[model samples]
Target: MSTVQAAIGLGSNLGDPISQLQAALQRLQAHDAISLTATSSFYRSAPQGDAEQPDYVNACALIETTLAPHALLAALQAIERDLGKIKRGHWQAREIDLDLLLYGDAVIQSDDLTVPHPWLHKRDFVLVPLAEIAPDWMVPGKGSVSEMLAQLPDHFIQERL
Candidate 1:
């Protein structure tokens, strides 16, 4: 199968977040259908929804993969499950969170997933790390990653890894 470029967002707030992210990256690299390429510097950001929860460590990864979009999503989800992710609640703290941020330039909408990550433009945690690795890549309906990062308010502070 032909390989396609894709980006994945990784976040963790529970336990040792940095270690969780590092192990997750290793898992991605171990997958036969996925070739882990570039990874952005890890960023520590305040949790978005519930201020009471712990801050999250975030990063983005660029990969070359032979898996299709849904398949890729499934693989990411599996990685989360293996890493002890438990869905406590929406925007709640978790062991690991993996999001399929983009699949090449393909636009997709379905019951299970959305490409360009639906909220990539609004979340600095995702955008900052993404822009670090792929500043020029466009987000389909949105503009470039750097452009989207420019439009958002500077409320979210992210410390580089």
Candidate 2:
């Protein structure tokens, strides 16, 4: 099967977040159908919702994969499960969170997943790391990654890896 470029957002707020993200990257590398490509520097961001939770470590990854969008999402969810992710509640703390941020500019909305992440434009955690690796990539109906980052407020601070 032909490979398609895709982007994934990784976040964690529990259980040594940096280590969790690193191990998750390793798992993605181990997958035969997914070729791990560019990865952004890890960033520490304040939790968006549920301020009671610990701050999250975030990063974005670029990959080339033979798996289709839903298949890729399933693989990522499986990885999260293996890493001990438990859905406590919406925006609540978790072991790890994996989001299929984009799929080669393809727009999709399904019961299970949404491409461009639906909230990509509003979340600095996703945009900052994404711009680090793919500043020029367009976000379908929105704008270029860099452009979107520019549109947001400058208060967002992300520590470099």
Candidate 3:
């Protein structure tokens, strides 16, 4: 199968948030269809949509995968479930959260997913970590992630852990 480069967003707010992210990385590394390429420094960010939950540990990962976009997404969701993710509501508290940020340079907009994540530009939590690992990566509609990140107002403070 042909290989595709994909970006994944990782965040956790429940339990040991940092530990959950590290374990999630391990699981992704162990997957046969996915090869973990690079990871950004872990960042701690305030909850965006749901302010009541605990603060979150956020990071970005670059992966080389043989699975198609939707299939890859399904695998990510399964990983989340394995890590004790219970989807209660949007942006609710959770043990872990995984999102398929970008799939190579592919532009996709389906009922279930959107490539280059719809809110990528708006969230410093996503851009900061993403820039750490892939400053040069073009974000399809947007320019370079690093450049865009530089221009956005620093809403949430992020610290490497």
Candidate 4:
């Protein structure tokens, strides 16, 4: 089977946030169809969309996977479920949030999934960590990761861990 490089955005603001992220990464690394390549440094940043919640621990990961795009997404969701992700609502706090940020340079638009994550260009939380590991990776229609990061204004302060 062939493998494609992919990027995953990781965040948690509920439970032991940093530990939750570490557990999620361990699960991803254990998946037979996936092999982790690189992971960005974890960051503590204020929540987006909602301010009432606790700050989040955020990071980005690169992987090599033989699973197809949707399957890879399913795998990520499974890890979230395994780690007790409680999705109260969008942007609300959770045990963990695993986003499939990119799958190689493929551009996909579907009811269930979007590659180069629809919000990838707008969210500096993901962009900072994403750029750390994939600064040169192009986002299909948008520009490179570093270019996007350079264009986005810093909103919340990100403290490196």
Models 1 onward score TM values of 0.97, 0.96, 0.96, 0.97
**In candidate 1, what are the lDDT values of residues 1-161, reduced to their tens digit?**
89999999999999999999999999999999999999999999999788999989999999999999999999999999999999998899999999999999999999999998998999999999999999999889999999999999854655887
lDDT by residue (1-161, candidate 3, tens digit) is 99999999999999999999999999999999999999999988888777988888999999999999999999999899999998888878889999999999999999999997898888898888999888999988799998899889757845778
lDDT (10s digit) by residue, model 2, range 1-161:
89999999999999999999999999999999999999999999888668888889999999999999999999999999999999998889989999999999799988988897998998899999999999999989998999999999744545776
Candidate 2 matches the true fold with a TM-score of 0.96
Two-way TM-score contest, 3 vs 4, winner: 4
The candidate with the higher TM-score, 2 or 3, is: 2
Which residue pairs clash in candidate 2? Answer: none
* True-vs-predicted CA distance for residue 104, candidate 4, Å: 0.6
The candidate scoring highest on lDDT is 1
lDDT of 4 by residue, 26-141 (tens): 99999999999999999999988889999999999999999999999999999998998877998899999999999998999999998879999988899999999999998899
For every candidate, C-alpha RMSD to the true structure in Å: 0.9, 1.1, 1.1, 0.9
RMSD of 2: 1.1
- The per-residue C-alpha lDDT of model 4 at residue 39 equals 94
